[model samples]
Target: MTHFGSNTLHVSLVALPDAVISTLAGILDVMNGAALMGLGDAKAQPPFQIDIVGERAGPLPLASGVPIEVQKSIDDIESTDIVIVPSVLLASGGWQKGRYPRLVAWLQRMHARGAMLCSACSGVFLLAETGIFDGKDATVHFGYADAFTTLYPSVTVHPERVLVISGLREELVCSGASTTWHDMVLYLTARHAGATTAQAVARMFALQWHQDGLAPYIVFEGKSDHGDGEVLSAQQWLAQHFSVAKPVEEMIKRSKLAERTFKRRFTAATGIAPLEYTQRLRIEDAKRRLERTDASIDEISWRVGYEDPAFFRRLFKRTTGMAPGAYRKRFCIPEFARS
Candidate 1:
């Protein structure tokens, strides 16, 4: 392990051709800002020394077609305190396995040397390629959850978390979604520097940390690619009629499968039982109504198929971790009634 001087820490931002340019630049800017803030203090020098390192030194074009000048190549760096892999624009065929063997090998070496690895969004794909995240929990962009799970089945994917720290030593840090670079940088700043410095940087950037998990923004679209014809038809029917009370019997009859068979197949395909699926669908609709309409919680709950207002409130809180009124208050349009 490379021992860092008491006053300074080295950081490497891995520059990839397919990386999102804004994320890379934004991380660098925030780190520099933190460093500057620390430097202003008489007793403390800046803790971070950041470098933009690429697979090969020189200019590397981002997915946006903008070229970022890299200060050093990965081969030139023998050791660093931290390594940050920025998100990449997924290609048409998806993240190609073994596409950057050299970079993967370098990352492996760095981790083996005890440097912490942090990834943002799809950058988790690269870290997964190193097998470092295998058997560990990690998060990535919600859009890529299915693909990431399909690719790395061993790693537990938390699609709803904005950030996750895994590994026995907690050396692997991951941030979900593309814009979560703000959250990741702030977290790193707080971990390495201090809360005061992190808060100052947050104030400077006007960046608010999203403490709520990503669940509120996620729409529970039923997965239908399970290749079960009867299940697919039932799913389609349920999607159209989730607001209907007592959908299980109707779904089973429409599927033409016996009750046991229908329930089993639906659970296997969707990872949730039929009634639970309907509840999720109804709650999803209720969330939409809460956000876009001035409707009261009881009215919205009944409209979404709940007959018991108290039951609906509990279910809403259980599913979303917030009361129905709180959800509306946070998400409802300002022009709509604020009740």
Candidate 2:
């Protein structure tokens, strides 16, 4: 339990000249929803509010052609309850020109004054650039692990994770990718809004998968009988090429079993039928791309070998409880929004 008497949580988004504001804005929307509902606490005061800050104050464009207006500045850094930096990718590949040096200095200044700062995805670069996380446990996008490790050898990097929460003395650093941005902010939401309100927000957003206790990835531990070398080989091979166009009858022959026996054994071995397992693989594959790339729904459907966009949408919705667009929005904000 935390003391909330006269205490406020201030969220500051570290903005660059070309940063995607909506990407961060969407997260604040989720946080706002939680806060407005009495912020999950009868004793706690209403949330202080979220403000976007950078060198200047005005509208900022997203890659999606959407220009989001800003209402604050890095000068607001000193009074922030908790500051957040969105993962800002840079062309220079380091925190110099094309980066916010003044904001970097501000982070260092605020940390020294005991203010908490958090980062999302590439935003870790901003904090790392300040050298505040040296010798501390921090995380960034998995794809940038090499560059991050090489660039900041003084820090302990947590790769292979979408989110990382670091609490050190007076500072708490929370960060991850956009998908994980939901998780980090929601965790804060739960603290301010209470568990019930946080759950409500998660349900409304169709983000049950972002639950605090859930693992980022599922690990299959099939029974030994199912993993009987040959069966596992068959499963892996089937995963490699079990397309919708691939005939199940041909695969039955390949498995050396009658169709009925094949179905039963497949279910027995994997807790799902062979065809069902193929769908799982395809869905997982689709999900990964949805998280990593900025492809349109129709394009993603084709890439995953689905011929009908409508059917693809249905399957994706059935599995994820959200549409492809929302899924992508949850991970990487689209290019048009980056404008």
Candidate 3:
């Protein structure tokens, strides 16, 4: 394993064929900036020695079809303080095991030798493939929660959390969603270098840390592909009639199954109960209206089938972790506001 001095941290970034180029570049730029900023202080040495390593040493094509020249192969690196795997473009089958056997082995070796493993968005799948995240809480893009859990039943998947620190020693860290490298890098910088240096780097890049996790942006569409024909029919009906008040009884009737069986099948297929599914649909609609319209919150609430405005407000906050007004202020279009 490579050894680090107290003054400098070595970071190895894994570049996969379908990796997001911007996230890779942004991480490098931020680490380089942190190193340079630390150099500005006479008392402190540079903070990071960053390298872009891949499974093979060559020009790798990114998701955007741009080619990035990797500095070295994963086999070339003996050890690093950290390994960052940026988001990958998931295949239709999702993350299949043994896809990158050598790379997975290298990651396992690095972690066994005490490297901190970090991933953003779908890159978490790569880490999960190494079996490092089993029996630990990890976060991924909210949209992938069901797929991820279904794939790795042992790992505790927290789709709504912005970041999660796993491992008994907290060596594995994960960030949620695309573009969450902003938080991952900042948090890493703070942990390895210092919070002060992290702040400077954040200011230098005009980066805004998402303190609210992934709840605010989640669009809660239920998963409907689980092959339960009766449950699928219920899902279809709910999609067309989600705005109706207390649609569960009708949903059960439509499914043509006993109440207990319908509830079980629905939750098994969708990973959520019927009532929560309806609430998610309503909240999703309310979020869109908040972003696109100037209607009062009460108006939007009633339009989405909430009879009691106060109850709607509470449910909105419970679902989204943001007040309706705050959500609008953050996401509202100026043209819509004016109109």
Best of the candidates, TM-score: 1
In model 2, which regions exceed 4 Å deviation? 1-6, 35-44, 62-65, 92-98, 209-339
* Candidate 1 wrongly placed segments (more than 4 Å): 1-6, 37-43, 333-339
Residue-by-residue lDDT tens digits, candidate 2, 43-79: 7665557887777788777545567677877775566
lDDT of 1 by residue, 1-339 (tens): 112125777899999988999999999998888655443464555758899998898998899999999999999999988999999999878888888898899999999998999999999999999999999999999999999999999999998899999887788999998788789998988888777778888988899887777777778888888998888898888888988868899998887888999899889988999998899999999999998888888899889888899999999888887788988888876864556
Model 2 gets an lDDT of: 0.67
Best by lDDT: 1
All candidates: TM-score:
0.92, 0.57, 0.89
Superposition TM-score, candidate 1 onto the true structure: 0.92
Clash number by candidate, in order: 0, 21, 0
In order, what lDDT does every prediction score? 0.87, 0.67, 0.86
Q: What is the C-alpha lDDT profile of model 3 across 178-274, one tens digit per residue?
A: 8888899989888877787778888888998988778898877677778988888888888889888679999987767899999998898889998
Model 3: what TM-score? 0.89
